[model samples]
Target: MAAEAQGRAPDRGEGRPLRWRRRRSLGLTLLALGLMLLAGWGAFTVSVQRRTEQLRAESNHQLDLFAAAVQGMVRRLEPMPATVQLSTEVQALLRQPGDAARVQAASSYLRRLNAHLGGMQLFVQDQRGIVLAASDPALVGDDLSFRPYFLEALSGRVGRHFAIGVRDGVPGYYVSHPIHDGAKVVGVAVLKIGLEPVDEAWGMLGAPALLADSNQVVILSSRPEWTYTALAELPLERKVDLQVTRLYGDHRITRFPLQVDLRVDEDSQIVEGVLPAGLGASGAQGRSAASRGMLVLGRTLDGTDWRLLMFADLRPVRQQAAQDSLLAGVSAGFVLLLMLLVNQRRRIVQQKLQLNAELEEKVTARTQALSETNARLRKEVREREQAEHTLREAQDELVHAGKMAALGQLATGITHELTQPLGAIRTLSGNAVAFMQRGQLDAVSGNLAIMARLAEQMGAIIEPLKGFARKSKAQPQAARLATAVHNALFLYHQRIRNEQVTVHDATADSPLAAWCDPNRLEQVLINLIGNALDAMREQPQRALWIDAAAQDGRVALRVRDQGPGLDPALRDRVFEPFFSTKSAGGGLGLGLAISRDIAREAGGELEADNHPDGGACFTLWLPPVPHDAVP
Candidate 1:
């Protein structure tokens, strides 16, 4: 009957009896496969949940160990400065200023103290507001009468922390203690330490570290590249609320109490929850290599309205669980098939062959589609690379144009600078012409001499412009750093005087030289000094200082002003092209960017930092010219 049915199927162009049996076998196989898949999924879910818990626990322990190690190091270093400040010998020097022996002894002690503290800057000031001595000799005679520390110590205050003077040429904190002469205030001892150590310590803690006041004004951060000092300047309430919300969402902690709430009148409660483990719907949309399963831990810093967070990937544990479930599902399917093999072996073998043929056809179609997609992707990549190159060239052109525009604006000032000599030359020529017309030979000779002197004066003004106009590829020259600074100052002297900005060149008398393009170095100076003047435009205390020195085989020049310092948020971006905060039409914002490029081309660099007392300082550092390279 089976053969008869098969023959009829072939006659009707339907199929054979074997084909029908294969189809029936395939239906049973599919049902069993579905059951096995469901079982595997169920097992995977439970295993993943348990493994996630384990990973969370392990990650929390690791974070705890990391935090402990960092805290220990910080605590150990903290006491060293306090110990030095409280030394009996340091107190003796503060009480007796005229005792040279004692002052010298204290100075030596202070130097040793600073060295022990890993090169921290230290200061000792008398109660009378006089800087009695310093670890650095340059600061020995500096008056601290206006400093907050001196004033506080004179009032008999105990140890206090304050922010003062830019340390290491950067803004930082000062921990100070009052020196007592019996019951009366005698003087104050202060320690200046860089925040870099704190930042490094935080890195060792396995997370980014930040120090903020109760108000959340990021006073210091280990990740300054990401966080700005302006964060501290924001309204305390806004900073606290926003940061608290983010912290809760990122960490899975259930409950937290806000400490040192500077914003609200009362403390606030915080709660955090963890989402379920799965292939997150939102996560799957992205192309990131990161897995879905993760655990987050968080805790609030004691004595501050700040939170610390840690995150760990749980993908490895989840993957192992999934693999185990897959193996179990395959094993169960094989066992079921074995039990059915006796009755359905022939049918099952035919079904397997038919299924294999369909799968192969689908794979071939998918491969062709993938090849087309890959070709399209390659074409898009090529187009993007071309677009990027074009954009870069356009940016370079814009920068070059902006520089030219700035130079053009300076033309008026340059002309004004030259007018004095030009006017004298005209007068001398007129006199010479009149003498020659009157046939007064001797008088013409005198005028000609005068003309010569005036010609030389005109050359002085033109010389700078000529140097500035020269467009040669950067070449190393044995140039005097001090001379370059002075020349740059001379070009801007009129503007500085008009703006009532004071110029103080603390460069040494002896020439400090470097291997650099003289014109380019001067251009950098011009840009920095000009910016310093502009910064003080609205300030009553307008002062500019151009200080230079040679240190560690480099020539360092610092241009500082009493103007409002750079907004911390904009500091890092200041050197990026066309990133201007100045009013429209005020500048194209290429000055600093170009200056930095020029510095780099000269084998140097430019850096900016906030002054401790509140100002901006731009520093240019260039390698000292090798004696052998000198022309």
Candidate 2:
């Protein structure tokens, strides 16, 4: 445009300006025509997207309301089964589960409830899972053990299940309540509900809808013929199970006629991808290909796996979209006409303006641009000052981090140096005491030889840290039960004799074994034996017994002492951390707590109970290694 104007300005001098004006008018007309077309296309695209979103939202809302109505109707009937279970006659009948005469009266009452409650089949089952009485007399004495509702109620819980009925061969939803004889579950009271009424109500609505169970079978639907249809293909195992149960009688499980896209979830995309051509011409109640494209919205019913599905016809939506496109096109055309008329009038006015007027407009625009550039330069200077201040603060943080790193290094060196010697001293001292009790003076002197190095340990704090750390890569293997018990006694032999404790070992001669960490198991025995010695300090008998035996594919090690038994109120809380009965300063109250954790980590249990004869008994149960699995 600049080259063209420059050439024309020199050729025309200042006399012939009409040709330049005509050229400008032609360029503006073509530009406006292209813009009008682009605007029309954009309007159509936006209208289609908006319509799709509105349809999706509207369908979802309708499905949600339908699901709520269905769930509410079922919930209103929940109280009936609970109320029937509380009747004295029902309870007495269930208590005498074998009495056929007693069930007759119950069956009569159930029949009356069915008549009054608008087509609900009520029944009762005994603990043996046999239907003792039912609203339908023929169902009495039938076995319903395989039903989920019966199984759940027999386990002492309220049961809710939706299944095709095995006994009556009809699809129904079941709700059951357990009938308790004192604290024991005696029988279950069940109510089988037919949702034909909900289906009928849905039929009156404009759109088609259905309610499907977890197995994807339509139990209630707006279209009556659609009932018992499966939404998706069934696995081989599930199909066989249903067939054996005869849940739907002779009706074969088959897929619904509607096709769905697995790649996308939105209703618009799913409807757009349906292939009616695959189902052939006589598919889905004889609906044509265009009519078969349906927008589907599904919602799961609360507290159950059942789903409510709503389908909208895509043909009507497409027709509405077409109308919207035509309206946008007409509007775009009107805008273009208005613009053309305004531009034509402006063209006439511009032709009358002098050349000096155009020069002045250009000068005004250049001045405004220079002022904006100056304002931006000032903002940059302010930003640079703030950045320098931030850099100084970061330098101070770096210095503080350096000091912390040096301090951490010093602490690590101190801890590693101190703990090594303390562990050696503790081990040597235990071995020395064991040798002395055996009357081996030479071995005791040999252990004393380590005393020169033990003094180097000095005094340091031991911290029981509970934080992230590298885990040991040890695997549990079978270990001797007798070895762990004797190790604990050997370590504390001198203390036992000094306290005047008479210790008896039942596992000393017996060959018993367990699957656990040997070191951890010994630690558990030591804590228990030490606690027993302290408990029996004031007792006259002063007896401690260690018993170990194998039973029920496991090893049981028990430690009993003739001391004050555990308090009945504290039995449940004895294994809790820092809950020792010992006086303050007697111990840190962590011995039993730590021992319990060790036993559990080795796949064993540590339990404390009061012995019947009069002392506290602590038992450790460990898993046993199979004879063939021994390494």
Candidate 1 colliding pairs: 217-232
RMSD of each: 25.3, 22.2
Q: State the TM-score for model 1.
A: 0.34
- Point to the candidate with the largest lDDT: 2
- Alpha carbon lDDT at 430, candidate 1: 79
Query: For residues 531-560, what per-residue lDDT tens digits would candidate 2 score against the true structure?
Result: 898898888879899998887777999999
- The top-ranked prediction according to TM-score is 2
Candidate 2: 10-residue stretch with minimal lDDT = 460-469
**Candidate 1 segments exceeding 4 Å error:** 1-473
Question: On residues 124-230, what C-alpha lDDT tens digit does candidate 1 reach at each position?
Answer: 88766666667876677676565554565567653333233532345344556666666776677777655455565655545434454333334444544323333
lDDT measured at residue 460 in model 1 versus the true structure, 0 to 100: 50
